[model samples]
Target: MTAIPAVTLNNGVTIPQLGLGVFQIPDAETRAAVTTALEAGYRSIDTAAVYGNETGVGRALAASGLPRDELFVTTKLWITDLGRRAARDALRASLDRLGLDRVDLYLIHWPAPATDAYLDAWQGLEDLYAEGLARAIGVSNFLPEHLDRVVALGGTVPAVNQIELHPALQNRETAAAAAARGIATEAWSPLAQGAVLTEAPIVAAARAHGVTPAQVVLRWHLQQGRIVIPKSVTPARIAANLDVFGFDLTAAELTAIDALDRAGRTGPHPATFQG
Candidate 1:
């Protein structure tokens, strides 16, 4: 098994650079998918309250018999649960479903800026961190302005900022903002949800490296110093995604992929997304 490198967060906690993401996996099927990843050497699992699959994740964790300290579990607070009190309760509920006392990481699922409640949510996360309910806290889909406000609160800075990033949508602005704040950038929808798998640049790189296009793209992300959680239910892909450490993309190859960005965003823009 290839040893996946860990990215040390600003707070000194370590997170696996490559992990399994259960974004759309239904509750009934998430356990098997997670189990497959764990068997293939994945220790990090990203889930959210909106996904409604934490119980399934709990089942897989229980069956794996992996020590609690060895696994990195992450869950999020939804927009409806953005206030300080609501955020705490939501995580408690998530922990109940996950069958764990503390999550490795917890995040505010979305900024929902219109509601202007994320600051309260961040405060809640700060309290949770102090209470030892979450080892680390972060925000997802937050733009630069949103990050600034969180930082201005003078509380715990976010350990990670997860955003929709891929060859088609680099999201460099937000990524840069996160970098400036000493926050690790985690790329979700890293393959553009398969939209970039067949691009000429990726295909050429795949052929040159004798790897799949998906592998080539994942390598593109890893080489750029970003955390990626590519989701796949196929057993072979689950194993192959972790095999990216065996290859490296050349500078020119990386640049070619970088040029493929077209501002193609599959999800709602964080600035105006109410939820």
Candidate 2:
């Protein structure tokens, strides 16, 4: 057990700084992946309705025998379901599939700006939060402009903003904006999808720390106060990802990694991504 640190969101709910992400894992494979993560001492599991594996995640959680309160489960509302009522219905459906009464955190999967339905979705999330169906609500892949608009609409400020952030794509500007509004930034691709594993800085740091490159990259995210959900289906990698809390990355090492940022976004642009 690595004793993963917890970050208290703007609303005062605490989330584990590191968690398991079930993005591409299929429904059948998701169960075992989540099971491996649980057995490896992970309490948080991040999934999206679009991922199409909440049912498998739910099955694993139900079978774990761990108290429901001890786990932090998060799922998102897909772009297709962006209206207020649609978002509400979508969550209920996700809840039904997950076999849970309420999700720890519910997020609008993306801004989907072109469609102009995110504000409505935000309202639905607020309604869910008000009714206790979602403990906390947030938006993912939202840029600074999107965040500003959501704030202007004025119902509930998002507790977290999930984005594609890694050493290669640090996304500091949006992160700063989220921080200014007291929202925590959650990094989805914290390891650059393995693109940065062989970088000289990361490799050097890993060798110095006697840890793997993946662990070094994860440690970089953790050391900077960002919440990370690194996805890995392999049991060894799943267990290794959580073993980053023991060592600290030096300031020079952090700076070297910071210099690696080149706006290399691994996902679609939020402003234009309809889905």
Candidate 3:
């Protein structure tokens, strides 16, 4: 098994650069998928309260018999669960469902700037971190402006900012903003939902390296220093996503992939997504 490199967050907690994402995966299949990834040497698993699969993920963790400290589990607070008290209760509920004492990272799933409650939600996360209920806390799908508000408030700096990122939607501005603040940028759709696999540059790079386009894209992300969570229920692909450690993309190859960025995002824009 390839050793997945770990990215150290702003809070000094380390997370596996590559992990399994349980987005859009049905509850019935989540456990099996998580089990397969664990058996393939994956130590990180990213899910969210809205995914409706935390119970399944918890079951797999229990069955794997892997020591608690060996896994990096992350989940997010939904938009509806904003505000200080609601956020705290939401995390407790999430913890109960995951059957874990603490999550490796907890995040405000979305800023929901329209509601103007993310800042309060952030405070709740700080309390969780301070209490050790969460090893680290951060936000997801947050734009630069949203992050600016949290930073100015001067609590805990977000350890990570996960967003809809892929080769086609590189999101350089958001990534750079997070990097400037020492927040690690995590790519949620690192493969562009299978849209980038057949791109001419990706295919050529894969052919040159004797690997699949998926691996090529994942390698591109790793080479760029971005943490990527590529979701897959297929056992082979789950294992293959973790196999990106062996290859390195050349500078030109990396640039070619970067050129594929159309500024096209597959998910909702954080600035306007109130839900």
Residue-by-residue lDDT tens digits, candidate 2, 1-275: 76989999999999999999999999999999999999999999999998999999999999999999999999999999999999889999999999999999999998988866999889989999999998889989999999999999977999999999999999999999999999999999899889999999999999999999999999999988999999999999999999988899999999999999998888898978886
**Model 1, which residues run further than 4 Å from truth?**
none
Return the lDDT, model 3, position 147.
88
**What TM-score fits each model?**
0.99, 0.99, 0.99
lDDT score for candidate 3 against the true structure = 0.93
Across 9-110, the per-residue lDDT of candidate 1 in tens digits comes to 999999999999999999999999999999999999999999999999999999999999989999999999999999989999999999999999999999
**True lDDT of residue 154, candidate 2:** 70
lDDT of each: 0.95, 0.95, 0.93
Model 1 error, position 197 (Å): 1.0
Model 1 per-residue lDDT at 65? 94
Score residue 94 of candidate 3 by CA lDDT.
94
**Of models 1 and 3, which has the larger lDDT?**
1
- Candidate 1 lDDT (Cα, whole model)? 0.95
**Candidate 2 minimal-lDDT segment of 10 residues:** 112-121
Cα error of candidate 1 at position 189, Å = 0.4
